[model samples]
Target: MLKNRFNIAASLLAIILSVGFIGAPIGPNNGDPTGGRPTNGRPTDDGPNPKQTIALGDRREIFADRFLIREMKGARLVMHPPRDEGPVMHFDQPWESNAPAYITILKDGDTYRAYYRGGHQRANGKKEDNTCYAESRDGIHWEKPNLGLIEANGSKNNNIILEESPLTHNFTPFLDNNPSAPQNQRFKAIGGTNKTGLLPFASANGKDWKKMQEKAVINEGLLDSQNVAFWSESEQMYVCYFRTWTGGNDRGYRSVSRATSPDFLHWSKPVEMTFGDRPYEHIYTQQTSPYFRAPHIYVAIGSRFVPHRQIATLDQLNELKVDPGQHKGLSEPFLMTSRGGNVYDRTFMEAFIRPAMGLNHWSARTNYPSLNIVPVGDGEMSLYVNQDYAQPTGHLRRYSMRLDGFSSINAPYEGGAVKTKTLTFTGKALEINYSTSAIGEVRIALQDENGKDLPGFSLLDSEQLVGNEVARTVTWNGKTDLSAWAGKPVQLHIYLKDADLYSIRFK
Candidate 1:
């Protein structure tokens, strides 16, 4: 790696970047730091209001992608923590060491499956390090079935998914949801090194695999991170996000690059993922996956690596048996969201998952989030994290977030409001996933295209909503039915006082 001027600037940005403040304006007004005004049309005594009417089905809309927020006052995006579910899988085999770090979790139909690079033993004794697999009925408990698929050294009596390829370094795969995808290629993966670039792999049952081609699809950066790819239903194409360099020694500093392919084989030239007005930080694994409930919303809950920024004391490291070479840095899960493009909306720069209250968590390479966030139970979702990396205690742990709860439009007790862009929907009632303090309340109002309050749907008619709920139907004038305005263009004026609105949708 060579240090350049841009690398120097990025290094400074990374060093100065705080978990809470990521070059965003979270000051008194609590408004859009980029100054985004109402998108449709400003409310005036004489203008009509419809910007572009959208049909909102049972889709759960979130603040993560800014698809709904047109203008907000005294409300900002908030990050939610993933509740730890403890370590569910381990690398205990002689072939499988504690170095099985880069893990991927996915919910396949009803079966939850996980894949990871589980060996560093090519230099030790094994023929090659291999990609391993684990399965679960529910995501909480895991079992590594003896797949008998690939032979790592001599025996096929292991959970190894793939072996004898450079792809095992950091193999990342996705369950293909593309309707036109071939049955045998239901599971697709991308992994390799800059020496050979990123190669594509496909599997019929996610166990037996075949290389799509000998040539690498992308060869821009040092593909050391867990390079992830998936069939994008939202864009009707295949999108891949992988590692890159900004400016540094030869490879530069850690950054992200994106490319798209109409077909899985051909891809556009790689482009760097940009964050608007935000300083750059090293993103270790950009585990970009589509939200299960709302397919349009893509979330990147990846490991934010801050190099050489040590926080653990010498005694603490010694007590936990931390690696002295890796102790100078720390990492945490940070979130970045996208609709479908090269840009990531880094609205919140805070650690999505912090180090646990212990000495082991303060070391480097821990807290790296897994590839996918899958639905674990009814109305609940789970994501796996690799913790205590490179230690004897290293294993994959689970964490959870509410459905559509990655970020929210929150209001303080002083009160704030969110006005949606003009939208048209065909639903009977408006429902919200929200929570409020006892004294807090939320009210909803339907507005005409001109931004005037629609009759019988004004804020005054809206019943005061007070409670914590995953789903609460908004009522107005003792009526919860919104069928009268169904299939028409309207805007939502939501007033919140000491409340957090996680998501909204209609039935």
Candidate 2:
């Protein structure tokens, strides 16, 4: 009887070992019972468990991407369109009657400067294009100053800045913000064709420009569009985003390429930007620049061109006086973002600046945005666009939005919650740019690294935040200061009810 009992026990032990039940149980954290390793087999050194905590030190984070969001219950990220401000200036001059394209506007100190190409064929039968200039005290009211630099229409009384043939076809300029940049090169520009490569020009006062080099500085990629270059404060270098053909040999869809330079003259090898897993589309003009408020994040309001996608009828085209062969393709603006890298995060793949309520807006090349978004008023920023292209009514229009209002974390009346990834910040209080209805409210809770609500900072203790404001300080139980939790790794549990949270910063 004893021998039989021993045999049974031995048989049971053998079965248990065969089923692999001797170790810890499988879990969501890559089967690691301690939750030390992520599913990607990477080991994290911060926080309590599966993921790493981010060190976001007092930088304003916009809801344009999912870089800081960890989880959400019923809230969603939504994109907001700008309000149309109507046409500010028309291409009505004799030299600008044909088409005025590739517009660029920048805020230089107290003054606003604008640059664009004026395309027209002279009476001598010479097809020449000139770079024109305009100025504005405020961004809304513009004046075409008589530059008197280049002669057009048998006189030098127009706002013609430069008449260099191929260069003026698409001359784009930017105000340099590099602290080390010489005063003589305060304003820099890049303009040329694919055949001539890209030529570099510099100016001290932005009205007079001269070539920095006799030869083209950048020779790689197709330099046919409004190639933009600027001093990147975050990257501490000069970066340029230009046009390129994806599949090479000028075959595939239109794309963008980037290159860096320690100085403006010597550039590194160009790297084509990648949009991960998104469907291929022609990106005609990539007006990419760093957001003025958040210099670390780059915003691109690019023109998405769809070839042969005609939307206007023949009657509508004839009524609008659109030029022949330019009505076959349609283009609209789309928004993209990046964090100083070659990968663009196209969160919203839809049209950002849609066509207006007229058939003329549905024509080809009608809504290309300018290169930069500049602050115009308190808590307000504006962007410019070229409208009614290839028509006699070609003009520039302004669009306005609240600062850092590109995208938002929105919730309906029923309410929802968004929990941020673990992070450490440096400021004593939290500020949010948000809007809400009459009955809507927002509440915030502070959670520890382990996801437990900290005492005195739970949702029950948070005061209800109501009304619409661009920068409102968040408080808990009438306490506004958060200096105690400044350097600690914590998570934000944002509860919203019929509200839109545009951006947040620790200040």
Candidate 3:
């Protein structure tokens, strides 16, 4: 049987070669430009079935308009703030006091760990930076435990995890999620100057670091910012996003570049990320990390800097006692989401978390978020930011958002509707993460792949849902059963009024 199959395959290949049918697309989106197509790729009237079978997984689908969406009402991005007006961790230590910045936090088991750059100190006679450490229990309160790992300022009683090298400058480490990664290389990091190139570092416990190799893993343009590299579960490869230049009418812009590596050692040529129709600006520290719950959507709370956008007066600046450079340039954390492919959706060209009302927070480079966002409380995740940069009051502050709450398909008291493209799912019931006003309500309707209303799951049958919940199941006229519809192609028509739908997934 195997021999006969091989013989048939070989005969077909020979026939195709003889007819010169190489590189021909055999199916939809198979590089077949000649296929009957539409802008939205909806099946033409009297054409093929308009259904798309989704893979078997409860993927957190956001309201990014990645697929076909229609009649979405007054939906927009919402900003989140810290629980209180305070910094989670302060730069009070002698070694970290000079200019503590480039913060990265990760949750390991029970304890949450943090790392930041310790700038040069005149009294300590240190000229370069050091990687300092901090830990937290609730992410709201942070402490720099004296690990005694690296000696600094004439003593080892410090939170310095990495020091005495250039790796300390912007050293960012990520928990290597690669199943095949070595036990000794559980945590991997990349940090170096553009001139010297990016060097790879690995650690067994994130405390003890070792160089991956003598050579640099990635060498590219203008990597002075906090360059981030991580293992993508969605893409199943190591992706590195760093700073570079985009030479166009948009010259001298502090842009972001992306590259992928299979082994985290060798990397492809980096390409600059494009924000469709968005104006050019200085995107400093593109803290691009995978959304823990929704790894497919790479969320970036980047520090968008304005080179000369001064918001501080001389007396305000003098009160903060910050460096002169703090008088110029301003920065705030902005929300950017990307579904891989080197494309970012800047749907909300606004600050996700703005600087607070203070003289210290109004300085240049302030409000820069940490390298990672970690899930903290139930249905809440935290994003830490470096505030009052170059000032004596410099500190790492925390901001929290509801899970999958970055953006939403919101509607006013006057109702609006959103219809999804055809998709096949393999789950019994659908659940949503949403919030609504006391009077607001949301209703969901199920339709066939061709937009025909399902018999018992149509709009008239959907029960009016109201309330705020991280997970709420959709019911239709007291009917919660959807087992029969599992593994079938369908569409979701959601009518939202005075509510925001963050995400939806079949369970």
Candidate 4:
């Protein structure tokens, strides 16, 4: 009888091996090693299975992408618009009277520096664009300091920094934070047109500037708009995002291209950025840069241009005193995020900064945001936009948002839950930047890779988190420390009731 049983088992094993089911488990409980259902009370569906565990070592993950999300019910990622704080600085200077395009703001130490292209029709009947400078003790109020570096309008008493043609048309600069960067090249800038390629400039103090090289370092694209370059801390190299046409030289839709360089001089071949499955649209200027709070994520507040989609009629354009040749198109700001690659995640297709309640904002090339979003006040960050473009009323306006408030996972009053993908984190506590209604709250549960709630970290043990804070620690049964589960594969099940979870980090 024993020999007969052994023969039957051997035959079954052979059949299983032939069918390639040797160690494969089958059924609804396959996700769990113990042949039990997930503790989250939901059967595993044929959705995206958890791949390799993400090693998020105390990094703050924002809700700008669906990277770490597994499943969500009654909740979604929502983009938040910045609050318009009105015009902060006017382009009323003689050199900046016509229009001020390609604005870039950098907060260096205690002073905020503003750089932009200022141009006005010269007496010779030619439009001469110059790179101008301004400084502000507070981001709210700006003053043009007469740097007297470059002579403009027959005077060196202007705030003109560079008067070189083509280069000053869209001069964009950033403070180099790379440790290996030379002291003289502390502030690096890129500017030029397609005719001249893209030129590189450097400065020891941002006030004094010189060409890093006599010739253009990058020469492969249209390079008409603001060609922005900065030392990427996450990539440990210099990255540049510049303007390019999809069909080639000013033929197809205006898009963006990216290139990298080890030394800012030698650049790799440019690669056009792809917006997955998104319909082709004119991306006039992609103000792509690393977010200050989270350097790993590149935030782009680009201008979406619709040629001939004129919102302001001729009469309205005349009423707003828009320039004669600039009234054909309409442009508005849009939000896009990326994770250090050629792909941009357009999670929110809506306008980031909608046209305000005025015809001046509806004019052509209006509502173009500046390059960087800088922090202004406590838990507040500000983004500057060029409103009333190609008009005498053109100025840089400030818009504010809560820190890390670009997008959030919002849940209604009926309540909802979100589950994160399997991840291993380092840290003793989990902190979140969130806001909730008076009667609303948020709760969190730590679960194993199989979605089984870990002991002492279940939803029932989670204390209700209520109120608004930029960073609030989550606790379970009045305990905040989670060091015991550090470096272990786990998932986060978050329950929310009319709350907005902006960002979360384990630290």
lDDT of 4 by residue, 1-507 (tens): 779656744643353344332233344322211133231222232113456687888889888867677666656678899998989998888888556889999999888999998876666888888888999988999999978777667777888888778888899999999999889988999989988999899999898889988899999988888898988988999999988878534568899999999999999999999876566789999999989988888999999998868877888888878888899888999998877768777767889988988788887898989999999989999999999898988899999999999999887876666778899999999999999999888888899998888998976677778999999999987999999999999999887778999999999
lDDT (Cα atoms) of all candidates against the true structure: 0.77, 0.83, 0.74, 0.84
Which scores better on lDDT, 2 or 3? 2
User: Candidate 4: worst 10 consecutive residues by lDDT?
Assistant: 39-48
TM-score of 1: 0.86
Listing every candidate in turn, what is its Cα RMSD in Å to the true structure after a full C-alpha superposition? 11.5, 11.2, 12.7, 10.8
Per-candidate TM-scores read: 0.86, 0.88, 0.86, 0.89
Model 4's alpha-carbon lDDT is: 0.84
lDDT of 1 by residue, 1-507 (tens): 346645744633342242122224333344553344332233210113336655665577887745666556656667788788788887777667566767888888889888888764554554465798889998888898998876655677889877755678888888999999899999999888877788988999888888899898988766877888888888999999888878546645688889899878899999887776567788888888888777787889989888868787888787787656667788999988777777677767778888998878878888888888888786678888888887778888888788877878887877777677788776798888998999888888899866788988877677879998888999986898888888787889787778989899887
Report the C-alpha lDDT of model 3 over 430-463, residue by residue, as the tens digit. 8999888998877788988776779988765777
Among the numbered candidates, top lDDT falls to 4
Task: Encode model 2's per-residue lDDT on 1-507: one tens digit a residue.
Answer: 779646744643453344332332323332122233331222221122337778888999998876777655556778898999999999899878456778899899889999999956777898888899999998999999987888787888899888887898888888888999999999999889887888999999988999998798888987877898998988999999998889634469899999999898999999999875566789999999989889888999989998868878988898899998677888999998888757777767889998888887888888989889999988899999999998888899999999999989887876667777899999899899999999787878888987778888876567778988999998886898989999999989887778999999999
Q: List the residue pairs that clash in candidate 2.
A: none
3 against 4, candidate with superior TM-score: 4
- For the record, the alpha-carbon RMSD of candidate 2 to the native fold, in angstroms, is 11.2
lDDT score for candidate 2 against the true structure: 0.83
Write out the backbone clash pairs for model 4.
none
> Model 3 — TM-score against the truth?
0.86
| Pairs in clash, predicted candidate 1 | 1-249, 1-250, 2-248, 2-249, 2-250, 3-248, 3-249, 49-449, 49-450, 248-252
TM-score of 4: 0.89
